[model samples]
Target: MKMNPITLIIVLVFLYPILKGFLFKFSSRDLKCDIDDLSRNISFIIAIISGTYFGKKIFIQHDDGIYRNIYNHIPQQILDYLENNNLIIYAIVIPIIVFIIYRVIKLILDLLNYVTTYPALDSIEKFLSSKGNIFKRTTGMIFQIPKGLCYVLLVAFALNIMSVLNVSSKLNGYLEGSKPYKSICKSIIMPVTNSNIAKKLPNILNNSFRIVIREADSGRQIEPNSDTPATLNQTNGRKTVVYYNGVTLDQGVKSDPQIDKLAVALGSEGTNTTEKAQMLYNWIGTNISYDHDKANKVLNNDFNVRSGAISAFETRKGICFDYSCLYVAMARTNNIKVRLVTGEGFNGISWVSHAWNQVYIPESGKWINVDTTFYKGGNYFDNPRFSIDHKDAQIAGQW
Candidate 1:
């Protein structure tokens, strides 16, 4: 029969101390020493397990506050480095802090044991020594069980860390293949450590791709007031466009002279609000391609969204956020009232975080939904069934 290497390793780890307990010959004095070692091992196990749980909880709760304090004192480059690698820093630093605290408590306990427990244990050891070899040996073997379990817990903790970090696919495969490891994690480690946070860490870290556009104010979608028009334009030589919610187009949307020029040229062909919006949308859908490289970086939380509109304009490539940002910029420049909406969209498999836009038609006096990102897929321009796929719509910004 074939044997899995990881399963073999785990079995060996579990069996090593049990074999030692059964095989080894020990005097009563040695058993007394083993008792002391068992006490220390039990304390160490409690400290490691509980300390890790509370430390992670505390860090998650106060991480933003800690970062803010450091931000004011550190150089921008250094702060950026810290922000980018904060998860790794937390993983290393929290364990060290917990170990330090454990050591200090252990020192106090050791001092108390020397003054009080040792003298009493000496009398007890002498009594046990007189009992028999059988009694002394049996007691000593029983103590070794907890010692073995302590080592098992340590291995489980290390595996948990590696899994959370996504250290290696091969190592992860080995861990998954090990039945002993899986049972230990499920029955013991997960309950103690609150492993849900560990499971969610990767998704939380990679959420930049999900929440691509930054929210404004409280980021809640408010229905437009009856007094507010579908479109607003202020003209005194320079045209200013506003949404039905009264947010000016230029506020969140970054403006570029080239984008403005192109928008003007496109809008000049349409002669109406809906037609102009359609022309800009069609041009973007035809010219721009989805940037897979940028998507990867965004997933890693490495891409910056500050220059997203201008970058998409120049490269003619972007993700959903970029498409929405570019559309808002161009539409506003052509005096069309628009908004950038963020929500989840079904990609025929699962609903993923996505961004799209809404344009106000002056003639119809209503705002219409549009998704240029799905332009290649189908007709997403004010489609009646748009709500079926796009869910939990929120107005990230209006222009």
Candidate 2:
């Protein structure tokens, strides 16, 4: 037997989760104590979760490059639509759907096996006085397979139609698919066949996405409503507090040599969001460096402004938390009400953990997020870049 990876994977995949469930059954005995009772159930559940994860990752990754592959492949359109806001599909829905199907299938198989041995497992038996329920359990299987097949066919037919239509413009959205759709599809046709396409997808999507989003958002019209939402709350106040404290002390020493250097470098407050934004921007970028990379330790760190912005008039390397704190302190010093913004940056990469700051301009009365990281080419600013579509960007433990 030639053991191909795909075949080996298929066999192991089915058994692994069932093995884990049995391990659970043996490790902790309860209603799940019956091994025979759960073996088929667990197998069905595993298939469902795998399907759901496959569905959700599709939409989030954006649309595909090929023609036929559009709805069926990784960048599939149908999966995106059904999967959006449907997180439960991954963690529970798929498993439930699979469980129901398998439960029915197993019963039918059991009944069929019984008929082969006894010629008829469907005979009505004595009530509770029966010697064994094994014989009793065999009675219900005959009708389930027909209903299960019908149910399976209906769902499969609907999903197939949805998957096909998703690639069509009639239902789902597409990225400008590329600078020009023809070029991108052509570029991918051969490489995709060779399996080199997945590595290039991020840049390809990035290139084509700006045009796509601009097209998508431009058509959106909204009735103007006057509702002021509160600023994004902070996870810690110490960063905000110490920044203002540094600024408070900086005010007295404004004429001192150290203060004069940064003041000139940052410029006057009335300049511009673009310009005044620079004073804080440059200070953070050039001064703060990632402190062994943990935001939770911000308060306990000893580097302070002395080894940071105060010392380096120009620096561009800091952790997301450090970059955010530097901007907060500098902006507050500029007399602006600065807020620290912290969040997940991309795809739950714990390493993508980040922070930035938002400031309120008295004239506009709106909180504008400022990302020294993005401005310095470090991390992306999710809100400005995608509004909210950037799943990788999360606002975690904001301060």
Candidate 3:
């Protein structure tokens, strides 16, 4: 699905235009442009609008419905298998369609002009056409356009056949109803239970919501506060302990806060998620320190390893892993959908793979990244905009 027609809409809408500027860098030779710019733009516009409105109908909602039905009818292993196949669908469709439509129109327009103009043929014209070796080389690439289309269609046809047969769901009844996994929590600890802290959490989360907003307005490259190393602690065998490093209003070791306390603070059934998140971000940055020594242990050895964000908060110091994991854990305690993201960071000195978090914002119907380690270090990228390295951030059922 990585090369799918519909899935490519995201890339097309966001990044394609920038590539044209780089074309001149490919060669110093002067070349006449053959593209029908108007039709190309029109095709791009149509593709974007159609892909957005129609693509969402399938990718955003219908797929979820299919998954729900499959979960009821299939086994977990089968469901997992189908999910992988389903990804293939998302990665393929829109891109092929967009390319086909755009190219077909461009080809038609270019041919129409050639037919209408019918450049006069004469001895002088022939002499001018005695193409130099350089002109032949340049023209050769353009002649390959039809060949390109055949290859594209071949790929699309083969994928379509593979999809129907391979994207199969089962009816084994091995799975169950889907819960918002990111919001579930397992630990319950009290962080000295400051009435003031309870009161302040909502306000803090609200402020932190601004971090997401800023991220949106700024270019995608300018990320919110992220971390290379964490100042929080590592975890013991417990998973809930790291996520809920602070006080727990509930008896659970997970970071889930007491609904009653939250309700009392907010004066409503829902807590001020934005404010609480902000406060947690602020608290972790100011209260903790990063401990890199614990990170020396490999993650596979301990699924519950607190070396990252989770562990850092527990030990009061960690590398990026601790800060991010703890944020994911604690944020979930407040009923926030925090996803742990594993990737690398660019810090000018060296490149290191790192972990961060993404929280789903219902208001935007999207997941936004939140990096606690950077905030802890005072980078303070407020109201950060969010995008995923990939879709569907996973969770440990325990939030």
Candidate 4:
């Protein structure tokens, strides 16, 4: 008969002691001890609290109590099939999981009790006579540590699987935070890895530029020529000193220590801002590709840039926002001043909302516009003519 979940929980609580007593007998028989009633009760409480608290955190709460985020990642057709047969799956699965948990907890408690009551090694030899011959006693002690570790790993693997499916905590966020450390290892293996490079330079060079021509529906020139003096640069009114001295840890531009490592590697060979900026521009322009799918979705809503830098580096694909965020991440991490600019620009055929960067040059005391996306058309650096087609929407954030 179907029962309320609250009733089921109360029933389990009342039955815990009966289960504990049965488990205690098996465990004490193995350890050859009369484990105290108080000690066993305490151990039981500790185990229940730890397992329940951690289990609740690992399993996402839902109407049914708890679940994995399997529904989010799986295809609709597969989910439909699973939903159609869920009762059969649960009937087969629940009992097996319960039995496994019972055995694991029993093993854990047995090990705990054994260790807590363990005598001195010299005393152990004397006790061996009461338990078994020395051979059986020695074998158990020898394997116990490794056996405990294996169970620990099994538990950890199960939790990790849950964590991966649960979107509240992102796997990519951990990787992004740790990328700097990985870059150090990468630096060590650079020479050997470089020799095996399979990406053809010719394909990259040939695919660098594209031309688009759009016939104007109105016989007028697509853009009105402006002799209007360029609008005051965003940097013009601000204290330039702050750009050099202050840190702007802008929210969307998430950076890690690895960017410092990357900056040193890329710009260490060049002394000037022009060279450093060019190096950064080239790396981003060639290494990353526009994410067509995400870009299409973004036109309908918005985009997230919190992990944009690492995501672009890992996937090698992103929209204009990703390009700008990654640029700012590396530049700021390395103590360079970079601003993410949101604006309107002609995407060859028609005007579209876009994002790019303006980098501060220390020696020149001026800002230079650099567009990685426009670099696809070649010659994107320090172009005065660039402002003619691109109009600033508003500056998002700067570092």
lDDT of 1 by residue, 135-231 (tens): 7666556757777777777777777667555566567557655778767766677667554422322121112334311124444433333242323
Count of residue pairs whose backbone atoms collide, per candidate: 0, 17, 81, 1
Residues 359-399 of candidate 2: C-alpha lDDT, one tens digit per residue: 67666667666665444333223233322212322322222
lDDT on C-alpha atoms for all candidate structures? 0.65, 0.38, 0.38, 0.48
What TM-score does model 2 achieve against the real structure? 0.32
Runs of candidate 2 exceeding 4 Å displacement: 1-260, 286-317, 347-353, 374-383, 386-399
Model 3, total clashes = 81
Clashing pairs in 1: none
- Candidate of highest lDDT: 1
Ranking by lDDT: 1, 4, 3, 2
Reference-based lDDT, residue 138, model 3? 42
Of the two candidates 2 and 4, the one with more favorable TM-score, higher being better, is: 4
Per-residue CA lDDT of model 3 for 38-157, tens digit only, reads 345545544533443343334323335653453466466754553445544335644564566667666776677456523422222355366564554444344334333333333333
Give the backbone clash total of model 4: 1
Q: After the best TM-score superposition of candidate 1, give how far the Cα of residue 289 lies from its true spot, in angstroms.
A: 34
Candidate 2 accuracy as lDDT: 0.38
